[model samples]
Target chain A: MDVLKGAVDFVQNKTKVEVNQRDIEKILSALNSTNHFWEVIFLSQKPFAVVRETINYLISIDFVKTDESGNLILTEKGKEFISANNIPVVKNYTCSCCEGRGIVFSEIKDAYEKFKEIVKTRPDAIVEYDQGYVTEETAYSRIALMIKKGDLVGKRLIVFGDDDLVSIAAALTKLPKEVIVLEIDKRLVDFINQAAKEHNLNLKAIEYDFRNKLPDDFVKSFDTFTIDPPETIEALDLCFTRTISSLKGAGCAGYFGLTNIEASLSKWYEFQKLLLNKFNAVITDIIENFNHYVNWNYLLPSLESSFAFVNVQPKLNWYTSSMYRIELVKDVDIKNEYINCELYIDKEAILYKEN
Target chain B: MDVLKGAVDFVQNKTKVEVNQRDIEKILSALNSTNHFWEVIFLSQKPFAVVRETINYLISIDFVKTDESGNLILTEKGKEFISANNIPVVKNYTCSCCEGRGIVFSEIKDAYEKFKEIVKTRPDAIVEYDQGYVTEETAYSRIALMIKKGDLVGKRLIVFGDDDLVSIAAALTKLPKEVIVLEIDKRLVDFINQAAKEHNLNLKAIEYDFRNKLPDDFVKSFDTFTIDPPETIEALDLCFTRTISSLKGAGCAGYFGLTNIEASLSKWYEFQKLLLNKFNAVITDIIENFNHYVNWNYLLPSLESSFAFVNVQPKLNWYTSSMYRIELVKDVDIKNEYINCELYIDKEAILYKEN
Candidate 1:
């Protein structure tokens, strides 16, 4: 099959990234054993772009094909190639209880129950704002993780977005000195504020877009900040610059959620470098598949280009993001300045069209 | 109190590391709230060196003092500095159940039970060999975590040391293609080899030290490797060079445990940079306080040099290490070389005497 040469050729022809045969072979080995598109990212640890590019290359060479039901299937040629290479299929071994997060909500059972009850009236996610709320368990788990890290409780916390109403969950503990949420959706803002007042919690919500600079009083004033940032490189840059700018100074903490389904590991690599090199931050924790979201309605045939590859519905809530906790070792230099490192764009959507 | 100038002078006179006002202030603020040497690192997110230096400086000026019971106390002047600053005393909010590890042994109940039973007869730790084993729960948790990461099943695995017997636990699962342990202590080697025979497992142990060059056949031969390395910078560099050299190529994984009590954040920063810049490895998971070690006898009267700060014995097993999982994105260049990376040194021991 000359798979090595074929993969090398495909990388040079189709992508800007320099593809390594070993990485490609690794992904190919994992894919050869799976027929579920939903499980592709879970199967291989390679970057999202490389996996997608490899699958695309396989499709181009008539080696693998997507079923009408959204499942993956190897073509006869692909089967032959895999057999010739003697690739063994490895079973997925992630723990089913914690879902590979290595954490559960046992310690925060009361908060889990409370968040679950309060989120019943939470606003629905809208495609316009690129919003998707996490499960209530995830919401409470985030609160628990922060408290465990000593970033919560008697600390001033700022949440970048409240789509998940994580701010409300944190305030429920009545531990933090204050809880402030800057969200673009007025519905969520009003809902969170209503909840805060009714519960008499030290929390408030302000309707704010992340692209705009934070107010002077808000900048450099928080002990910790949390956000589910957009996946695009530009948007991620802007979102982080704005959110991180709110930190009082060094020893401050920030929480972020990055997804494997949308953001490639290359994007993760870039963001990680940005955190360490530019911001002088040390990443303390990253738990994979930690933030599992409620399946939103945006991808149900409404998003034609994205859903085209998946002709049918996914059986599970597969949109999960890794949770990150980072501490700034140096003060951010810029504050109260308009920040959009560049215009935020959704390149994955662009890839959808091109592919 | 002129605490700012005090810290500035202290940094200049006491340490080689760069000191920033914001970082020192953050540490001071968090420290003003607590008095336990064990709690110092957890109180603030600053690097270990800065935290240590700040505390030492406080003692120099009679701002902080140690109680005979080992608790930290503020001198009359230190009390004045804190009151003038109005620094809030933040309560420790770590989850009591998980102890901030996030994951419990709920899912691996059977494996947890089995590992606990088997490790009962394991070799006792000897400080001369830098040996201290983790709790049974921690040993099983490492196995479960690796399985959750999809790095165990049908993959060749290697262990740099066997003091923890994590290799034995993985062999218990009967999942890996092969499990090999390179350990320095023959007691551990014989014990693990004996366990392999009794359990009918595909695992073998060889009495090997990390400073020696890896055998040719062992180089670039494994899919995954795990270790609890010595925390000195030189030891860390050499140990990583040897263990990482055993990986097959890109997509290979490594697991390591780094203790906060021994290694400072500055060392952590340097090691992290080595992983990213030198080897092109991507860190996927890092959970703090994930490895809780059993209290060994070495810290009693036998280790007076390190225990000088504490007159009384500890009430709990305060020694813990963070767990890390990293994946290689590129192949390592060197193989089978006597790699000392500058003869392995333990400067922390020297610091104990000098301080």
Candidate 2:
């Protein structure tokens, strides 16, 4: 049954709120249920007299009231009581038609089939390696978590490398004031736009290869940005710099990169340096570490370049697979102390005194 | 080795910050490494090193930076450069420690043993049914998601029912102004308090039975509240009423009740009626018919109560064994529309409503 309509019907019947009879009938029919006497109904071709008893029982307890017009209504006292109390109305026991799965398996199957077909055509797409396409389960759960936390609201955000993850998150999140997407791949940009339409999401997607220049208009406007660029340390570094420039003071960013153990270790250093240099934003938490195959050739040189810039030491290890999430932030100030940068140049020396 | 200290050490080295030789030597000794070079460092023992290197590399290529004194930093030009440029970082290839499975079989066995002990005492206390005790894996993932979403900071919240989930979520959240827990079970309250201390979290666990009157000081103070009452509908109603009274106008509340489909439905109806009568709050989402086990006895009544309240239909269903997270908000007039309470119910209903 259309759960929403069913809810409306239940509210109407319980609260004595006058609603269209046709709407009630439509809802009942959708649920494949037929009303018998006053409150009794049959479901799944089985008569259920208990429903009537329960409704009558509710009336007896003064929880519900019926008007002279035969419209069910909560009593004046009941209404006031419910409002002040902030109570939730029971809508339905279980959606009989869907068995409470929310979506019909057939519909899901069809969507999955379509998703698979689209994936099949893109043999080179990295999504195919990790379950073909993203599921609402993964996307919505992540989005809901964000909303609950307040991260997706009122933050200037940028999406680096438009993909299912970013687009889905953007679509589901409560609209931030501004949402910017940097996409070098035209096909991905078009796909993101189409998906946005389907979801009625407002996101500004720009087609620009991040390896070059960024749009001049985006300087210093963002508060939070996400980086999930192509797998290469150099490219990652480039993306980091551009996004960092557009952030407001104390702004934060997140990145999800694909790297091997050595590369992951190497990129970790680069990520830290970028965070420290740009916003002084600290890495608060690491998200996850999972495995997938993505081309990393382009990122390798950037990784090498980043290695030359800063020195790093390992602390803790956690992983599910090859990929990992590392949290970082701008370095904290310690009194008025300063370190000599030249000390890092002597790689062979274990000890160097500050001059 | 202590993870936090290790991180501090790695950052110190990577940034070329001056640290006493003793401190560096101690850190190295703890990590079981003799070399200053990060690349040759043991993978399992040096996460701080890995993260430092990645950040440093990003900084070196002008992706990130640090000042004369070795403090990790990100440059504004660097931020603009990365996103605008579309840089990518190398992916981690393998699990340095376990090689991929994330945990050694021995660790799994040890965890299993601990789980058995926990289950022997309180079987239902642990979530993720198959897993015995809470694992870092589950905790970290949940916490990470919460952080990304922004649920972790700067909000005033109350948790109704102190349990492992509530306590853990509160602890892992980034930062909040305050966290108040209302628990009926005194033992649970004690447990929560101890756990909070262990985690160094600032959480207050108050012992208050919902069946009794609410403390006057708590009226209309909370911005968000989570309700997870016992399986009894009667108790549920009392708890719901008290919780509502404590919420500020426009505040949201989430409830996770037991499964007595019929009773739940009835209770939901009553609850909604109460909300409408009192705060004019509306139900925004409902998840029923979840894939998890349903405690039919409690769920039925809860479902019934939830249904009879709102005109708007629920968007989601809760049929699974997983706990339900419902969102609701108090309805307010922003543009001065004459939302007549009289139109919905008569003056008699006014008696039951709280101002």
Candidate 3:
């Protein structure tokens, strides 16, 4: 289920006109009759009391406002908010099966309840685990840690995937003063927009696939980038290169790596090598076995090479599975630094100074 | 750049070998020589000094020990410590380029000079940010987190990837644990094995592909499972389902969602719904945008329903691009467990039970 934040934003930012209680009620009535709203309500088939409570909640949240003519109009703030945030405004559509009640509309509620209970009782003892994706929680903590470290504030950011945790984190953390979310899925663009509106978060969700050329607006518009492209290393490589081209001097980037599984080891290594060749970022942090089921690592690296100058550092975080958090920074000149000392318990610490 | 923890665990659990300085050195030497090590070192060449310092610091942590035979080994206490804690033994390899100098042979001195300059300016930046598949520091933290969470205790864990983070996390976290790492790259497998021998970790690195059926021995032999399969979600799903079949009742599993900007909003919804339907798990947490450069999301869900008759509360930690932390715990049976009370602040203090 989608969060109501987008809807809230839409109402708050879009509707310019004032709204009253009567207008609110009319909107509620209209919503109740809408195919989309009816479908959801019917499917949930929660008590009418719950539905009424939800309606009241919507009104209380200012998602619906009244006009001077006593008619319900989405506030200008709400409309602007929705448009800016990319929240979906569903049009007329009806459920073919349940009509609006959402329920199957059959007399099998008891049977359905019984079946659900039975299913709930049967424990799914199977545990299938794979290393491909990282957990959302780990992703958030990693970013939070970066913020805590002061690595991600006010940076021009470009994201390669719009549907995953990375996009959500960007929307929530407010790391990049400006964030451009690029996705190939139109539906995801719509969904992300909707979600953004609900939360009143301002982000640019662009519809573009990595396999194709990047949007013209994104040429060299970012100092930091993240490439969590599709699994095909080739695809990842292409996306990484494109992102690199758009990165300013000293820009950094992060990418996901394959775990140490027998099946993925070779490709994982190859992917790593490819990244090194394309970017001058340092591998700073990693999340090991993030989800208990997926044994994958995230490579956080910063850009620091003559080819594409960017000073960066990597960040790491881990969770249950072999998941990793990698962070990279951009534009570091590596010609003046040196190891100052070596510490050994028995021997005096040795110091080396740069000449 | 695999962690030494996996090797440490293998030696401690699978064999009766004691790990000492020599063993540690050997593992380190092997790691230094591996392509993975070289990759990391090469990527972070600018921060060579810092990387060297970090490595030395980790070696001095006291958790790593060397044997009289000059083989790096965990002390008896160390073995007991890791085993008791269920930490995976990681295998460290030596650098091949500069014979552990962490420099490319041709430009050893020049690289070192360059490294000093870079680190001096950005002392806080991690040097080996993009080396190998993962980093050692991240691996250790991941393992420690798992041990703290009680997920690694006496669990039969299977890891699909073999990066430093996974190996180290598995080796360093928890005791009395069994771990199997699957890899497809033969070179890495060899490097990992050598590292495992040197560190005395009880981990076995195998070679296999998920496109083919899983090995027979892996059918139903695990308590906890981790898979970081290749990027294909379908492949990841199949691998997860197959692995889940092997887990015991109530066993926990984690998976990463392969996300990208090309992801359709509908697909994102469908992916979550699919997880809920197949696993009957409560999506407890998520990590939003990891970086503005990638659109990835991590989903953490607890298994519920009756398929396995086990009431499993799955905890999830997600890392996102934007560095936002989104933590969620499954709220189950709240009505039956707690009473809500309301308090008034205006007049005399008053309390009222909710519902």
* Better structure of 1 and 3 per TM-score: 1
What TM-score does chain A of each model score against the native chain A? 0.88, 0.44, 0.44
What is the full ranking by DockQ, best candidate first? 1, 2, 3
* Model 3 stretches astray by more than 4 angstroms: A1-136, A255-263, A291-355, B1-355
- TM-score per model (chain B): 0.87, 0.43, 0.42
Better structure of 1 and 3 per lDDT: 1
- At residue B43, candidate 2 shows an lDDT of 20
Misplaced by over 4 Å in model 2 are A1-149, A172-178, A261-264, A277-279, A290-355, B1-355
lDDT of 1 by residue, A182-248 (tens): 9889999899999988889899999997778798898889999999987777887788788788898
Q: Where's the lowest-lDDT run of ten residues in candidate 1 chain B?
A: B342-351
Listed in order, the DockQ scores are: 0.25, 0.01, 0.01
**lDDT digits (tens) for residues B195-302 of candidate 3:** 456557676788755445556677656645554333223543555455455454332444332222222122233444434435333232222222211111111011
C-alpha TM-scores of all predictions: 0.81, 0.29, 0.28
Task: Give the TM-score comparing model 3 with the true structure, all chains together.
Answer: 0.28
Ten residues in a row with the worst lDDT in model 3 chain B?
Answer: B346-355
